[model samples]
Target: MDDVVRRTALPGRSQSPHDKLARGLGYFSIALGVAEMVAPKAICKAAGVEGIENVVRGYGAREIATGAAILTSHNPEPWIWTRVAGDLADIATIATGLRQDNNSKGRSALTLAALAAVTIVDLACANGLNSEKASRKTAARDYSGRSGFPQGLQAARGAARDFKVPDDMRTPELLRPWT
Candidate 1:
């Protein structure tokens, strides 16, 4: 029947904060990766690191891959976790730079601090995603076919059929006691 159309959640529904953050990180990764790939030497020089242009370009590639994953994956939790791993690697790289007897120790330290902040955000977003997944799993098991509506689908359909709409209210007329 025409009235029996199936109802489902919309695909273009509003995104949660976590989703927005993940998307933002993905965009950030792509931008940063492009910058690094395009100007690895310049980046390293600005950061006070030396003789690691190849390494910087390698990191740029990794960032591009991670960003693409985050942008395209339906569940970006794993990708975000990967970002956390990348952050750790970055910290290690910066630490190495810090140990170098170059003038870029201060810049490396600042970079490390920034990486720490990004790591925190990545971890928080990953945890939130995991919790949301767990909650969905739990909710799916909460309702069984035989529990709430004991009479089953037919009874539910009958209830829906029995539901009445007041004609006056449908036309936006003044409310009055039903006689």
Candidate 2:
């Protein structure tokens, strides 16, 4: 006799269903913005210096809004979040300048501006912020990695071996006293 076996697929390999949904929505909005930006008439209207200014303002506003939101979040990784927000805000301002009054100069600045925007957006979408417990653990790990941290003290934690009192007799004292 022969027997048949069946297996079911497991989730969480690439992305959770929720993450996929969010990404799809985000991409869709971006597509719409691109379409608007590239429209023939829209391009003509915003082609010269004046149009670039408008584009810069629009992008800057978006960055400011997003940065504010991130900064205000109660996430445990507040430091990282704040940094990300500040970076975004900086990029937005640079991008505005890159748009330029006459659309001239600032090639390198424009490149950096785009990079900043992409990084900030990626962070926002990834939801990479950690919880309070995780943040604290990470902080502790970083702190312990510091130099001049007295390895002798850390090693003497349990046994109190290396932490014994000096051999010189002062008052009566116990070496390696137990807690």
lDDT of 1 by residue, 1-61 (tens): 2111112223334277887888999999989889989999998876667888889899999
Q: Which residues of candidate 2, in runs, are more than 4 Å off?
A: 1-50, 76-179
Scored by lDDT, the top model is 1
Please give each candidate's TM-score.
0.69, 0.26
| Count of backbone clashes, every candidate in sequence | 0, 0
Candidate 2 global lDDT? 0.43
Q: Scored by CA lDDT, what does every candidate get?
A: 0.78, 0.43
Give the candidate number with the greatest TM-score.
Answer: 1
Q: What is the alpha-carbon lDDT for the whole of candidate 1?
A: 0.78
lDDT of 2 by residue, 1-179 (tens): 00111011122322433344334434443453454344534432332222444554454444444444433433223434444554565455445544566543355365565557655655554454343223322221223434454675576467655566767666455655555
